[model samples]
Target: MTELDPVIHTPARLRIMTALNEALEDGDEIAFPALQKLLDMTAGNLTSHLAKLEDAGYIVVAKTFAGRKPVTRVAMTPAGRGAFRAYRTALLDILGGSR
Candidate 1:
């Protein structure tokens, strides 16, 4: 049996990773506000989950200015993509065993 990634196994984190994996193309990023809206998570809740993913080296959060306004962007790192793939495989394996 394969071990699941505890960091991504949490429901919120799982949703975050899945969203990133599905939404992003290579080298593309999503605006923080857009991601929050898509996930339907409160700003604080999204930030908290983002911190966990960042700590795990699974995502990058960049804050910069768009003209005079502050803008935040999020992107999955290569390591994150690989981790997500592994997590998906582990989940599939677990489900496969039940049949």
Candidate 2:
């Protein structure tokens, strides 16, 4: 198995993608605070990477009014999921996963 080339893989972006991929596994929407806490990232940091992901059509951001407050949720798109799976597989291949 071939590894994913670093040309399209960045550490920070990979972290963001991994987080979204984990969230999808549990059938729950990811909230900003929750994601921030999980990633231990600042708002600015997250925004920059999220912008890249959003621009790539890998994730969708939904905004809604929760009574008086606004709710923002991030969900991985199908394309995102597929890409993440491939990325994971490639990474494992690079690591030579135990058979």
Candidate 3:
């Protein structure tokens, strides 16, 4: 017996992973506000989820200036991309390909 990697299976985390993975494949990064809108989550909720993903090395958050305003962007890490794929596959398996 070997211990398995900690699984991030929470619904919110799952949603975040899915969204980040989608954007990465499209060669685009999602803005914080857009993610919040898409997830229909509050600022606190989004921040908490983002922190969790960032701590787990699943995503990277970049803070930069967009002209005069500060902007935040989130992108999936390589490990995150792999894990998100596995997560989707696990989900599909559980639902038997119908959901």
lDDT of each residue in 1-99, candidate 3, tens digit only: 222234458888887887677655644678999999988999899999899889988888889998999999988888877777776666676667853
| Residue ranges of candidate 2 with Cα displaced over 4 Å | 1-8
Give me candidate 2's TM-score against the actual structure.
0.80
**Which portions of model 3 show Cα errors greater than 4 Å?**
1-7, 94-99
List the candidates ranked by TM-score, beginning with the highest. 1, 2, 3
User: Candidate 2 overall Cα lDDT vs. reference?
Assistant: 0.78
- Supply the global lDDT for candidate 3: 0.78
Q: Output the better candidate (1/3) by TM-score.
A: 1
Give the Cα lDDT of each candidate: 0.96, 0.78, 0.78
State which candidate has the highest TM-score.
Answer: 1
TM-score of each: 0.95, 0.80, 0.79
- For candidate 1, what is the total of clashing residue pairs? 0
* Number of clashing pairs per prediction, in order: 0, 0, 0
Q: Which has the greatest lDDT? A: 1
